[model samples]
Target: MAMDADLVTAGVLVIGDEILSGRTKDKNVGFIADYLTQLGIDLKEVRIVADDTDAIVEAVNAMRACWTYLFTTGGIGPTHDDITADSVATAFGVRIDHDPRAVDILTRHYQAGELNEARMRMARVPFGADLIENKVSSAPGFRLENVHVMAGVPSVMQAMMDAIAPTLRTNSALLSETIDTGVGEGLVAEPLRIAQERHPEVVMGSYPYLRDGLFATKLVLRSREQDKLKAACEDIETMLADLKGQRQAQI
Candidate 1:
């Protein structure tokens, strides 16, 4: 039997001192959120921890136990600070080994002179982990159980996501419909709240923006079931139309 869409949840763990210390702005959070939403996976929580092994281990343990799926970005490079693989291994009580499949990809891309020890470190995977292909670079990321370890580099991480996304079970794509109201959120909050209560299955949100010295609000209705999203959108539209009619009638 199919279950409710809200029953599934996922989490993301970003591993980097650069992000924690404000040295680097993280771009993967929004990208992963959007990607997971497309797969009908609700991104429930996100944790950004420094490159410390204990921090990474703690986050991996907690998120893995809670969420249906856990994705981690960064700390997978060959540099000294890249310790995510080992940290994950320790967390899972497993061993880290050089994955042959990853090595094969690296070997094909590089000559003997170019294949150095540092680059080979990227091939290491936690015990019983599966390699995630890096289409942009020879170095590969990995997946263990429900946790997916991906690179911090956007291009490489995107390629890894493409390779692994098809293998996982996906629910229905989340559908969202939006309408721009030429009114502030405060003006429409009451009606929107009523609309939301009427369609509890639909996730409704209002984003206010300033455009051309005027305030406007974008009302969005999101849901995994397309029919529910459409129905909710119609209700919201009807309410907004009534509000407009009232204003015109007064004028």
Candidate 2:
């Protein structure tokens, strides 16, 4: 299907063997999703890959081509396993070397003897890439085309996101309304399906949960168009009201 030109979309790539091995719990994906959503950018997909160069390279190329923007986290550190910058360089077929700007930042942040070879690895970036500032740490992230590579630390990644947010292209913010149906999903499924069919533009979903030891559902409707979302929500309310009446009659 052809995507709406007005809709801006993004993809997230999380890199690290620690994450894959369950050694590190990821916190950046949800943060980035919320951040992008507020800016009217839809986060369409997320991929978690190990710290392997081939895997990172493949994910970078695939996601960057598929979405308007691709945000990556992890593997851009001083350690030997920190290979995100190099992998991204390979993906773009660009030369990887110490970016003078990044090196300068690290030099300023660290002491005379602290900026060793291991630490210098953080300065390496793909050719022709713009630096993404890291307020938490001196080691900066880089923006190579549409792909943004940032540190794995939550605080640092967030800072990079803030640095890059202003420059991003955004679309209309998605509007959403949630209705507590006060009933089970099974009872509301057919009605929700009908409402979805009637208002094809609105995205409708029913989330089932336990309330007071009984089944309950929350129906959420979302759309970029306010009028359509409001209309669809009203129709859903009416359907739920009718369903309630029918249940009472049966009782």
- Clashes per candidate (backbone, < 3 Å): 0, 0
Give all TM-scores, in the order shown.
Answer: 0.88, 0.97
lDDT of each: 0.88, 0.93
The candidate that wins on TM-score is 2
Model 2 lDDT at residue 207: 94
* lDDT (10s digit) by residue, model 1, range 33-120: 9888887778889999998999999999999998888999999998888999999999999999888888888889998789898888
* Positional deviation of residue 221's Cα in model 2 after best superposition, in angstroms: 1.0
Off by over 4 Å in 1: 1-8, 245-251
**Residues 1-251, candidate 2, lDDT per residue (tens digit)?**
24787678999999999998998999999999999989999899999999899999999999999999999999999999999999999999999999999899999999889999999999999999999998998799999999999999999999899999999999887899999999998999999989988899898888999988999999988898999999999999999999999999999
- Residue 111 lDDT in candidate 1: 81
lDDT of 2: 0.93
